[model samples]
Target: MTRSVYVTGIGRGDGRQVVELGMMELLTRQVDRVGLYRPLVHDTPDRIFELLRGRYRLTQDPATYFGMGYEEAAALQAEQGQDALTARLVEGYLRVAESYDTVLVLGSDFAATNLPAELGVNARLANECGASVLPVIGGRDQNAESVVAEVRNAHHAYTNLGCDVIAMVANRVDPDQLDSAADQLRRSLDVPVYVLPDEPALSAPTVRQIVQTLGAEVLLGDDAGLARDALDFVFGGAMLPTFLPALTPGCVVVTPGDRADLIIGALAAHSAGAPPIAGVLLTLGEKPGQDILRLADRLAPGTPVVAVPTGSFLTATELFGLDGKLGAGTPRKAETALGLFETGVDTTELTERLSVARSARVTPMMFEHALLERARTNKRRIVLPEGGEERILRAAEVLLRRGVCELTLLGEEDAVRKKAGDLGIGLDDPALDIVDPHTSPLRDRFAALYAKLRAHKGVSYELAYDVVADVSYFGTLMVQEGLADGMVSGAVHSTAATIRPAFEIIKTRPGAAIVSSVFFMCLADRVLVYGDCAVNPDPDAEQLADIAIQAAGTAARFDVQPRVAMLSYSTGTSGSGADVDKVRAATELVRQRRPDLLVEGPIQYDAAVSPVVAAAKLPGSAVAGRATVLVFPDLNTGNNTYKAVQRSAGAVAVGPVLQGLRKPVNDLSRGALVQDIVNTVAITAIQAQGDLR
Candidate 1:
């Protein structure tokens, strides 16, 4: 049985981060699963949802799991009184508790000694969920009396409500006062008391962290200001074909001179449209050409454009390294990135760290409509290739009703509808589109193109048609032609089979030498990206260089700065071989082609990942031991190696996240699990939103 815990106390002054971190720690202790429920969040403008989405990367919205909107939930909290709120909260908690072995109940910020009416609600909820409550106290000022009062209140609430009190955590305590606070608090409370230290500014989120983790140099803008409050970084344009993902919007590093076309293109593609520019650092210290100046004037007129003396745009990257402004700013994404990197935290670790705990005894409920509504509001789009398989249909139906995406299933409308109905999957809405490959306008176009291209190859028209009719081909075509923003296939195909069509029909973006695959490995503390795993069998030096470049770019797309490490069996010049030679050559190529990229190669895996190993193997290398992107020499090494790490090292593999396509299109293994499908869709949606440039 999976050990399960419930997390409450979200939205109570750092309560969210506290509960999230606590749950993550618990998960590392071999817990089977950890779940969080926000039963009674205040009615705000999707702040809770945004928090969940941005901080935790949760795909399911609050409404879906709780059967209440943020507004409705807030209203219920006020009108229904504590008893009613507790009942509703408990009902939801129990619904999620059935799947786990043990559930950890998170407490709210309201005092345990609140009015009897309010106490009853919390107590009742805990009892119904069959969860033992763990009071997580967020110590804002660390007052002894206040702390004691909070604990006593919690104890009374739990006892009166007929629930067990397992433990109590005093979160975010000042280091100097931690001992006294813990001692005083423990003496007053019956539960075990744990004091969590106040994290340093280094522990806080900042842009410097993001930049260093990605191995990207700060091109322009005030690093201090950017470190604080920069939300999304937008990277796009014709230059996007050559643009690195390392420059997200809050940092707004411009391609020197009059590359306003790039900026305009990126702005047009942004989901929220373009955010106000933080600042623009002109690359190469060049003035905008007349056309570019005109475009910039029309688009972002007052945005400051800082100039550096670097002659070439690429040379401007050196400014980031020279700035020496790593630790400045509040709400700094860079700082967050650095803190995350320093602790070696990957995406999985971060996600786990942010998960909340729930109770095991509660009966889990499926609030399909709520989930669907949230997905719809988020404008998520999930693709289902036409075959009308029962599993696919059922999955699609559940996802659709829950508002996961604008569902696109490939097949004749009649057949798809029949299959859906037969499978008990409802699809009576206009949002669902059914396309028959044989009759699709795009398919016909592909057929014509293929026939013309292969006419002299002795391939019959029928054969050409058959090849173009493959779902993978059609799906790639959808992404290429903008019919769909992204695709998820591989349920009935091999990786090669899924990818071959993309390679042939979709083609690489101009200047991209090879298409590569990256695996977003989610570990306990951080996300480590492995690349060239699914594509590029035995990449040459040039190909390896492109893989490194593309892999780094991909990291940036996901808000991760690329710290590229060109991996080989040897460290530095320790070994001599075609493989090592290729790595060394590729490393140089990356330095030459993208001088801004922090890349080093001819390094062993251990040296690339472990600081100790890196120090011993290659003392002076910048990327040694700190590399975020690992480029393998061949498929044999990249594929087998990453799989071995996934199984043995216990990393949650998130992708074969395909990169370098004109749009966001990825293939799945034929036997992809449901969760795999869900994650792929999420990743695709994110990519689609950013693919506008």
Candidate 2:
């Protein structure tokens, strides 16, 4: 039977997309095939459905998911009565449900639709579709008591109309009143209730939204800059001296294009990091001269500069009316929405209630989601050495917003703050700490500690003092000294620069013979662990065995069942060579040492992963075709293979996550994306949790 979850709001402005997107994420995590159905949609493109399709990578055709447009729905309900309308919607939903393990049903939006009593209609549709209802109530303007009453009323109305109300949500509630609202709902309602505090990021429109809504020409900014949420609108009227003080972070400055002084002044302020504006909007179809525009580009390279034909009054009218939407183009907003939903809702309980069967395969997104959820369970402090990098700053914002872990970004406090401000990252959160290793008092202490620890090898404290000032050494020392639980770096530095300090200070774990690394190669269907990919150019038989053991342990820790495969050029001793001999020897060593581990050796990649090849090459071997942990003979092989799979197969390679470290110190590629940093940070936090325990 296909389990259906219908996320419907009482009215518009409920921000129910958060609930809808959150449910989609949870569903994807649980099932391999999930479908989405919208009973009624506006004439315009369904933004929420598009977002789900893109974000979840749904393969269903758009036409199959939408039952009918609002006009068609209203016309049908009027002409043939509500029963015919309900039957048609149920027919569409059943078609979608037939092919999917689960279907997410979106109820009608009460936005200018002539449908009578939308709540009752939604209830009827949900009841007819056999979807458990997850009702969303708008609490934007409601007091705590009123919000509680609204939830009660919504839930009662749904139940009265023969809908199975599985849960209730009070969305966009005031942050300060969340606890009050939640408490009142708990006492007043019988079903589970979740309250999401109003997130300004979700509500604020992006520069792209502004461009599209006003049909403005993009005169500047990159896609990333345009994705920035405009938090406040600043109308440019005052002089530079007076207007500068009025500017706030993430504000979009609107003014006549002839006001070159204000435009340049705002861009200069943004460049200097006093306040980062989303973009500068030129009004009345007038723009500055080429010289001024050139200077503005230099002032803020990626800041959006757009021009509109309308005057300031009309532009402001459209800007004020524009609200942020979740769609194909707005990924940051999706992240923010998911973060808000995950934090506010009791997903475990909801999952149990939904009774979604778990999928056997773990996709890349599922792996990343698991990492975050595991990290958030017991939060740890992770130190990032590359604090000034834009990617690092953006990833930090995601980490903080998701409440994954506390972070200490190692850099000059002012410079870090300025950079974060320039990127529109909110640095005011207490979970974030900025440190300047050169000036911090801990620098001296760390230097002294380093000198003492390395006194046998080195002769001078002066050398250690200078070395500890570097962010990598500072972060590694923080991990060693227990100031931070883990460290993730190398975004803007070499891997050697990031991990060399770890070797010097943290050293290997107690039982480990050598430090090795594994890349969580996330393929389309499952996540496979590839060992010794980024470290150890070559290893002897003993070192190879140790790497295998460590890699297996790492795999087990991350919930990948350890069916060890010692990968080689040969399969099951079909060929003989120095490389195959080393792998065969390592396989024997692993079986002898672990005794309980499922180990197979001298296996080719195809034989290790493909059951068909395994049957022909190495039949009846427990670890041949079902291997989760693949240990390569050397770094030359492991590195090339992982890279080949990553590029050719479109796999998401998540690491070079160092194993056998005393404390968690993971290194990233210099070209790592913001999401890569986030995953590595989460991995480090989870490792820190194990270390702490």
Candidate 3:
């Protein structure tokens, strides 16, 4: 049975799409494939559906995404009956449910529809589909008493009609009334009642929404400003000095177009970052002169500036009435909605209540999402030595924006800041630490420590001083000295140059002979581990067995269970060679030492992973056809095979993760992308969890 959760609303203005988006997020985190269905919708295009489809990678047919248009449903109800409407909805839902593990059903909006008893209609459809209903009650502009009353009514109405009401949400409540409403609703309802405080940023209109609303002319700025949320409007009626103090971040400027002084002042304030204004609005259908317009562009190159034909009064009235919805354009709002939902609600508890079965196989997305969640749970500081690189800066922006971890970038401070500025990346905030290795206060201390550690080799502080100036060396010292939890580098350096410092200083972990590396080859449906790819060139039986054991532990760390495959040219003694003999010895050693592991050796590639080949060759062997960890005999074979599979299958390979290291220090490819950096950083953070001092 496909477990489905139906999010229905009572009347409109409830902002129920947040619940739908939140539910999609919750479901996708637990499963690989999730389908979306709307029982009823308007004839116009659905912005929420578009957002969900693009964001969640949903590929279900767009036609099957909805049961019927509102006009068609209402007409059917008037002509045939309510049973006809329910049956058609059930048919549409079953089609979608057959394709995915879970289905998220969106109930109809209460907008100019002719259906009888709109709320009751939603209840009947939920019953027909056998889905648990989560009704969202609108609390905006309502007192605590009314909010509590409506919560009780929505819960009773759904349960009384035989619909399984699993949870209730009271959204858009006034900030002052939030505590009282939450208290009253929680006491009144048996299920969970998550309350979301009213956010002006969600209701406040963006520059793009303003353009679409007033049909305004674009005088300046770009999409960045267009998507910016205008939280408040600052009417430019005062002089430059007095008005600059009134400016606020994410506020829109409203003034007469002839008032070039106000416009220039607001733009200057925004450029200074005292508070970055969202955009400027010109009223009375007047635009600034060409010279002033050029100045405006120079001040803040993409800050939105729009002009309207109406006066400021009427524009403000419409702007205040505008309430933004989650869509493809407003990703920031999606982030806001998700943050609010996550902060206020206990999703784990709610998920247990819903009781969707977890998938046995781990998808790449699930693994990646799990890594991020783990990192965020206990955020550790990660240092990027390639701070001057563009990809690192871009990844830093994403990491900080998602609140993933704390970062301290190592380089020449001025050069790093300039490169980040040139790429249009923001690194000026205090949360980020941009350090110049040459002038760092910790440089002397690190040099002394390095010299002390290498005194047996006749190394002095002078030699250690020069080496500490290198970014990779400095970053490694930071990790060793407890300044940073972990380090991710190699965007422009070699792999040996990246990890060589750790081998010298941090050393290997206890009870481990060699440091092995693994690449997480994320295929389309599942994640597989390919180990010893970049570290060992050639290994005897003992070293190969040790590598296999270390690689297995790394696989389990990332939640990919271990079923080891020692790859070679021969299969079950079919062929004999030195390489095959070595693999056979290593497989036997692993079985002898750790008998709990699933071991298969001298297995060809096809025999290892293909069911048909395994049945013909190694029948009924558990690890023959279903291997999660593939261990190559040598670096020559492992490196080439991993690259070939990556390019041919179009898989994302996150790797060269060094196992058996005392401290966590990972290397990146010289050509890593922004997302690759993010993933590597996340992996590094997880690796540092046990060693946090």
User: What root-mean-square deviation over C-alphas does model 1 reach?
Assistant: 24.8
| Residue 358 shift from truth in candidate 2, angstroms | 0.9
lDDT at 568 for candidate 3? 93
In order of listing, the candidates' clash counts read 56, 0, 0
Query: On a 0 to 100 scale, what is the lDDT of residue 425 in model 3?
Result: 47
* Clashing residue pairs in candidate 3 (N, C-alpha, C atoms within 3 angstroms): none
Residue 63 miss distance in model 2 (angstroms) = 2.2
lDDT of 1 by residue, 177-234 (tens): 7777777866776556566655533233234444444343443334333343323333
Give all candidates' CA lDDT scores. 0.58, 0.90, 0.85
- Structural similarity to truth (TM-score) of each candidate: 0.49, 0.96, 0.86
**Residues 417-444, model 2: lDDT tens digits:** 7677656677888999999999999988
Cα shift from native, residue 495, model 3 (Å): 4.5
Off by over 4 Å in 2: 284-286
- Full-model lDDT, candidate 3: 0.85
Regarding TM-score, does 1 or 3 come out ahead? 3
